[model samples]
Target: MRTVDLEVVRGLYKKAGAARLKLDIAPRFKPGDRVKARNINPPGHTRLPRYVRGREGVVERDHGVFHLPDARVAGQDDRPQHIYSVRFSAQELWDAEAPSEDSLNIDLWDDYLDSA
Candidate 1:
């Protein structure tokens, strides 16, 4: 199935997509909102990994604000997103073998979480 119209449309999109762009990102939450990492898997992709999913964590810090990523990169979305440092106990992220006296600092975007 070859369609000249389809090919032309695709080529036009490819040309328009080469332009550099900028965006504005807004903070997702206040200082104390609780959020959990998203749990998902897709073929041929590298993400935050499996050990941190579904873990309960607190918003320990905020990094002001920044622009969200876009289709040019993985998990990229052009939107205002807040960044935060979420803290999780080592045991929560890594079960039995996790050390008792340590916690992990995970930097996450606003879209990567929700009220927990």
Candidate 2:
């Protein structure tokens, strides 16, 4: 099985409206909920970064459903996947000096997260 790159997926969507891409995802979590990215390195590939693995964060926003992408790459799939904007405190994401109120927001796929 081969995986497509995010650039290609973006190009497809750019050339052909979102109609070419199917949007679907079932959300099991909501805003203000604590969650962590799954800690699994599939043999093939994944989009979830190693840095984010096991990192704790809070769900801040929901981007709704969208085409599922291969974790390693950006190939589109018919499967529904929930996209969430999670906020990670700068201090939490990195074990360094970070403003208590500073945070980073990231768009993560459903499979990349689990209840914290």
Candidate 3:
């Protein structure tokens, strides 16, 4: 394995730690669109949090296209897709006793969601 020295790390994070790319790919969702998180459990690296899987949320923002981290980790590079901020009510993720007015926003890739 190659060691990442300071110079290499500096070049890798030149964008201030953002992997965002300059692409014109169309987004799969938009704000106000209801979506459901796909219950996927691949036998490999994934950024999807377990608590949010199979939950419903509203698309809050389109963060543009970027390479899927999971895909990259699996050696399938070039899998670029739109990432969105999805908002879920605390009650939906937890229980009815949770505050109804409270919601949590999590950034999710297009592959992780479907129209609700």
The candidate that achieves the highest lDDT relative to the unseen native structure: 3
Superposed by TM-score, candidate 2 places the C-alpha of residue 48 at a distance from the truth, in angstroms, of 1.0
Error of 3 at 82 (Å): 0.8
lDDT of every model, 2 decimals: 0.67, 0.77, 0.91
Ten consecutive residues with minimal summed lDDT in candidate 1? 16-25
Candidate 3 displacement at residue 34 in angstroms: 0.3
Candidate 1: tens digits of C-alpha lDDT, residues 27-76:
66666777788765544433355676767778898775655453225565
Better of 1 and 2 by lDDT: 2
Q: Where does model 2 exceed 4 Å of error? A: 1-25, 71-77
Residue 84 in model 2: lDDT: 88
Error of 1 at 50 (Å): 2.5
- RMSD of model 3, in Å? 2.3
TM-score of 2: 0.70
In candidate 3, stretches whose alpha carbon ends up further than 4 angstroms from where it belongs are 1-14
Clashing pairs in 1: 25-80, 26-80, 69-77
8-42: candidate 3 lDDT, tens digit per residue:
88888566737788888888899999999999999
